[model samples]
Target: MASNVNIEFRKLFINNEWVDSKSGKTFPVINPSTGESVADIQEADEADVNQAVQAAKKAFERKSTWTQMNASQRGELLIRLAHLIKDNVSIITELNTIDSGKPLTASIGEVLQGVSLLTYYAGLADKINGQTLLSDGPVFSYTRREPIGVCGLIVPWNFPISILCMKIGPALAAGCTLVIKPAEQTPLASLFIASLFKKAEFPAGVVNMVPGYGPTAGAAISNHMDIAKVSFTGSTEVGKLILKASADSNLKKVSLELGGKSPNIIFADADLDYAVEMAHQSIMYHSGQICCAGSRTYVHEDIYEEFVKRSVERAKKRVVGDGFDKKSESGPQVDEDSLKKILDLIESGKKEGAKLHCGGKRMDRSGYFVEPTVFSDVNENMRIGREEIFGPVQSIFKFKTIDEVIEKANNTHYGLAACVFTKDLETSLTVAHAIKAGTIWVNCVNYFSPQQPFGGYKQSGIGRELLVYNKILRLSLLYSLQIKTCKIILYCLTYSMKFCVYEMI
Candidate 1:
């Protein structure tokens, strides 16, 4: 929590200039703690989307200087941008805290991690390489790991800076131009980041942002034929829409990192105290805005009673208050809309017969505050247990068998992330392998690295992003058969072909 977080920030950023909404219509960015208008953001539409696309197209077309530059030189530019971020780290961190109305500690610390990711990707820029394969046919048996064209990145409101760094660092490192659409709720930090990129002189349209609603801006990015790749982070439902939209349109490469209703299973032998804390952190962090939030808690039948008791006590102890207030452990919800959804889900849980174990009421005051909530006697079939509540709410269940628990955990449309807490390495390995999520944790939750490839299974997403040298891997696999001779000698060895002189050299 940071009482120092302020919200009087910039409105919009497009093509290196700060501007207002196209129709002069501004949307209020509320401080969830105070229910006050902290800042106003530009409400972009199709016109703004077109502007961003055109700018990206122009920048990508001007491959003369940027495209011609050595990968090492491009890496230098990214390194310089990283240094710039470090120099002005405080301002950007504060911007994130204010705009998202999340805890200042999480905001500030995650922003620094974003800078680290940029630096890491910068260092990796020159290392991206395709391999010289032992080809079946003759010719240049090697591939060139190059970039795709102008890419469109649509980031979510939750974990904005960190997620933005994930896409931008890798996309730029791959030498792709971009058009960015930041979520409407937390667009200020993105606008400021655009300003930072401008200062870093990221070659005008190498990176451009248009902050707006998802329907207009987000849809536009996917449907646009000019975009060669689309990287999106949001809900599973919306990710499906983006996938359909891209398929209906250009069939361009679409990468989606979507939702999760993670399960944190605590066996009888696990430490009760540590289990309670991990359960809370799994769903309570960022007011439960995490996509991979461990909303489901499955405890062994032997310790189930004690687990719920301690978990409720822990939830009650949390100081629910404003995000800006440094002492506030649980901050307000992002806005009225998000709070309504959360409260509605809480009521749904009750109406559906799940017992409310702890805090479930909205705070009787200004701002979008909900008490640190938990549910007990929850069935796996309940909507609260099945759907992605995406709030500071937790539910507990009991199980006897590891296989049964694994089935309960994987019984969802989502496969984003999951957790297991036990000392038995054999059991840990077994349970981890059984879970269907993209990432699994033995005793950890919400842990991530830019180096680790992150995405989901089923309808959770398609393809992958935030990966290093992944482009090289794909290029090598896709184009390893680029060689072609007349007919009979088409399958000749690389060393035996006439073109072998240059290919082998």
Candidate 2:
């Protein structure tokens, strides 16, 4: 086994120990900005995944110390982890920046988000208690919330630590052990954090991270009967596979935060300046790699042309270069495949008769960089208009009325998130209520809070993450009956069962 200092040869972290894969397989993780290999990460196959799951299961059994620990103790550990992350924010940020090809500032912000989530869940751990029932019965009964055994957490590469905390914080707060499968594209920061878990004195097998591809490690986690639950954040197509795998194995609980082709509706009676600025940031942030990116822009016909012009100018001013560069606002795509996909989508938009406002090609460099592209006169049928480009590309559509825009915006199968830029109270409320999305932002874009429950309606996702409500979902309900004084046994047979249950809205 290699030492923890040598992160380049990063290995799987199972049972609080860094070990090589059973099959001795490893893959190269590339730096998208330079098209160079950042490190060769150890790959975990089904065998490795099973070993990790077994370890986690053992740690989660009824008699294990981890499961028996006090809820407040667990919260203290999470708080310690948060402080550790804050102390080492620079290293984590750099690792994430090079591994995922996102700007340094963005990576730093993501790490801070992770820390905040951890802290939030830490404070919420001891407070996760059931309520008293108001039933009129002589029998005393209450519900107990217990950890849902071992959990399988699968996180994506875009916002690595941010999404990981969304699951890890809550799972830990609920006293559930884990077997995490970090994305192959960006595994550096995850491995580093695994080491932090060790430093924090987290028990062996309580929180394990296995870096590998989705097919093997991810599939094993989803299909493992011992795994009580699986929380996945990735594409919609992959989310389907996970749902099937869970049902096929043990009918384990599944939570999915999947893809989105979200729409940003800009009404005429709104602040055009703020709308244009936010719209640009919505699509161009992280080079449009966000799952809930406002990719499809629906502008009111009254100011559609002007909005498009300003949006294009804003895109042109953004500096695209190395992620570590202080002056660079945007970076390259994750890899060659992502760059190719974005280019292909741009061509399809052009062929489909959408006017290319500017930047319809890749930058002339050795890296996997795509220009910040914009398209106008885009109809619903155009490929770029409906499909998620997942790159720095925007497709603007013109609408005349609120009803028409609402109908068009809600046309896609995805409903992860949507934004409305309007000052009119009636129009904003009506549009916000009418849009079938999990998160509806009025006069803002890409704003997230740990307290707000986020998930999707349709094919976008199945469950939520990063809140006290989500923490409750990671637990199982155990009801116990306490016989108090019974009046008439035969006459009291129709009495309501009084049991305390925690409910979320």
Measured by TM-score, the strongest candidate is 2
Q: How do the residues 1-505 of candidate 1 rate in per-residue lDDT, one tens digit apiece?
A: 4345454445556566666767777777766777778667777777777787877787767454567777888788888888887787777777777777776667777787788788889988888877676766665576777777788989999878878888889888878878888888888777777777878777766787887788888888889988888889998889888889888989887788888888888988876787688789879887888887888999999998889999999998988776677777657788888899999999999999998998888889888888899898888788898988888999888899999999999898988777788767778788888888777767655656556667677767765656644421236444742311110001121222221101211
> Which candidate has the highest lDDT of all?
2
Specify the poorest-scoring 10-residue window by lDDT in model 1.
484-493
Candidate 1, position 288, lDDT: 88
Evaluated at residue 132, the lDDT of candidate 1 is: 70
Write down the lDDT that model 2 would get: 0.84
Residue-level lDDT of model 2, residues 386-453, one tens digit each, is: 88889999999999988999999999999988888877778877888888888887776677766767
| lDDT of every predicted structure (CA atoms) | 0.77, 0.84
Clashing pairs in 1: 1-326, 2-324, 3-324
Local error of candidate 1 at residue 170 (angstroms): 0.3
Residue 72 alpha-carbon offset, candidate 2, angstroms: 0.6
Q: Could you tell me every candidate's TM-score relative to the true structure?
A: 0.91, 0.92
Residue 69 of model 2, lDDT score:
89
lDDT of 1: 0.77
The residue-level lDDT of candidate 1 at 343 comes to 91
Q: State in Å the error of residue 88, model 1.
A: 1.8
